[model samples]
Target: MSTTGLYQDQHLEINLPQAMVSVDEQRLILTRKEFELLAMLSANEGEILPRNVLLDRIWGYSEEIRTRTLDVHIRRLRKKLGLYGDSYIQTIFGVGYRFQRFREPRALISYQSPLFAATA
Candidate 1:
């Protein structure tokens, strides 16, 4: 049996057995909910986790129920994480949230339609 469930990426590390999180080698003191929330998001990585799904998973809330609990927690988490949280955890407007390793630099890439491909 493995007591340690490690979730890590380029900048973050989560140790489930110890309920510990470290970002860029700095440890963060987090509440139980905050830790859980971060763990969930980190586990999913780049995937967009729906609000309903997060509520259900973290708080056992039904999809029919409406609340701002998730938002509040996210805000706190972002504050605690500082610039890292702001850059990683993203709001999908009316949809939900996602945790990405780093902000994508899509603006640097120019888009070319198929019709213009031959000319360029």
Candidate 2:
């Protein structure tokens, strides 16, 4: 149960058990949704997590509900992730969001397979 995820050249770390995200060793104050979004994206780094998948996973399943909440949360997460945010979480344009690979940290590289793993 290794829990620390180091990304962005090791400037960012996501501690799963703590549900804590830190940038350059400074803890960020994220809403629960923000933290969950960050955790989900980080856990599945280097892949495009579809909008529907994110909505269901974060907000729980709800009859394909339409809302701008996901975008809002992503914006907040990016802002908190600081300068290299967009480089980390990328927009795939008309599809979904992809968590770009900052670097292959040893602890969690196993999940960084091809982007379409979930769909394929």
Candidate 3:
């Protein structure tokens, strides 16, 4: 459970009640299933959630059932997340998926000649 139904990190923010998601401060339009998937993964953070578990939690599917719903959703989510998708969502392979915490981009150091000369 997140505070005030909100899950937030350095690069992502999710409002559960509003069913809204934003990345790097930019809002993203997502489907209902997509939002739920992202919410669950992000909430768990670094914990790896197996396919069965995710299926059950998200779609009420049994472990024995074979389907590509999860995979499809994951792919869609990744594509929607852009560059941050792969960086944040990780595949366990033969297991499940996990949402990695977002990390702030490193600040770039300027090495302009004028600035360097002025400092010198």
Candidate 4:
């Protein structure tokens, strides 16, 4: 599994048969819930998955839980990603989150008038 990043490329060499995730430098020891969450997000990268969806997938909850359990798990996953976490995981306001392979490109167009310009 190859994951492209901004500064450096990140990949998870997983043995699907054995259900193991290994990085180049260190092994990311994940809890059962963490592993499930990571797998789900990785499976659908760049897609904005809602909180309810996550809860249903990971927790298998029929009814919504009034707690920050999903948030906590996400935080842990972010921590596991270390320094490069910020660039990969993005927060969508009033919506959900998305696991990105790379940072989104910034717009080049400028709305404001130029402060200095050559006079004709």
- Using TM-score as the measure, which candidate wins? 3
Q: Which of candidates 3 and 4 reaches a greater TM-score? A: 3
Give the lDDT of residue 68 in candidate 2: 87
Per-candidate local distance difference test: 0.84, 0.78, 0.88, 0.68
Worst 10 residues of 2 by lDDT: 1-10
Q: Name the runs in model 1 displaced over 4 angstroms.
A: 1-4, 103-120
The numbered model that scores best in lDDT is 3
Instruction: List the candidates' TM-scores in order.
Output: 0.75, 0.74, 0.79, 0.69
The ten-residue window of minimal lDDT in model 3 covers: 111-120
How many clashes show up in model 1? 0
Per-model root-mean-square deviation over C-alphas: 5.0, 11.9, 6.2, 5.6
Which of the predicted structures, 1 or 2, would earn the higher lDDT when compared with the native? 1
Query: Model 4, 14-44: lDDT tens per residue?
Result: 4444556655566778888887777777666
lDDT tens readout by residue for model 3, 10-70: 7778888888888888899999899899989977878999999999999999989999999
Candidate 2 lDDT at 45 equals 81
Alpha-carbon lDDT of model 4: 0.68
Candidate 2 residue lDDT tens string, 1-120: 123554434667777777777788898888888888888887788778888888888888674688888998899889998976887899988778988756543585466577657775
TM-score of 4: 0.69
Q: Give the per-residue lDDT of model 1 (tens digit) for 23-50.
A: 8789989999998898888778788999
TM-score of candidate 1 versus the correct structure, residues matched by position:
0.75
- Kindly give the number of clashing pairs for every candidate: 0, 0, 0, 0
TM-score comparison, 1 vs 3, better candidate: 3
Q: What ranges in model 3 sit over 4 Å off?
A: 104-120
